[model samples]
Target: MVSAPLPASALPQDSKDRLRLWIRLLRASRTIEAELRERLKQQFDTTLPRFDVLAALYRSPEGMLMSDLSRYLLVSNGNVTGIIDRLVSEGLVLRARRNGDRRTSIVRLTRAGSEQFRAMAAAHEGWIDELLGGVSGNDTQRLTAMLKSFRSNWEGRE
Candidate 1:
């Protein structure tokens, strides 16, 4: 497949705006995620996906099913299953066949898992603080509000 080079002036205005927004988002996300992962490894010997799963489980009032975890993490069922397998093997998570539902399993964070998650959550917040400390508090608030507004508008679309 052959693609023609796009001159900046020739590109649609909306296309250029979308491209710039995506590029900024991707770069910022990557840098922040990379730093978070590095700190997680150094401090907790965990990865972002594992932390994400545990964080989701931490938020569930009655725990979460494997399918629910997959959806919450925006990952494939196979991926969630593999993550569950490892966490269960490490005794950080418990998987039980739901009452009256042998085919469905609900997973919960164990006491140890909760403690680990709390520590990780603290460290994660510290990392975020480190990243944004240079920015003024008011600016941070405005930026967060703007992002929320943008997200609301974006979700309202389509």
Candidate 2:
């Protein structure tokens, strides 16, 4: 059994305000992410992780090593391997052994993959714009800058 947590009114003013800000940020993030995931599934028949993988590969036309892809995506190699396997099977990506290193593989988007990703990306941008339309451009810029600053200040702080 567990007791209920204290209400927000019990906290000090500053603490309460910070808590509220955190909650709002989290809620907004989750809402947007859920919307994006649903849109991706419905419109593109894809998942966010898959879109992310394709986006990363699209940025690096020359290709990326499997290890590098995992690192860049901040996911484990096994997770990446599964997604890569699916993409390869779908003819959307190619995986080839690196020269002089049979143990390593490099992955890149195929021409078909690149074209498909471009289309998806365009629709994604439009969806995001529509979703965030309530915020003015100035507010968006200010909020973005504040978030960047917050991340910069807190990152690697443990």
lDDT against true structure, model 1: 0.91
The TM-score, computed over Cα atoms with residue i paired to residue i, of candidate 2 is 0.89
Per-residue lDDT of 1-158 in model 1, one digit per residue for the tens?
99988999999999999899989989998998999999999999999999999999999848998888898787999998898899999998999998969888899999999999999999899899999789899998998998999898888466
Alpha carbon deviation, residue 13, candidate 1 (Å): 5.7
Q: Lowest-scoring 10 consecutive residues by lDDT in candidate 2?
A: 3-12
Q: Write the per-residue lDDT of candidate 2 for residues 1-158, one digit (tens) a residue.
A: 99898887787899988988999989999999999999999999999999999999999999999999999999999999999999999999999999979999999999999999999999999999999999999999999999899999998886
| Estimated TM-score for each candidate | 0.86, 0.89
lDDT of 2 at 29: 91
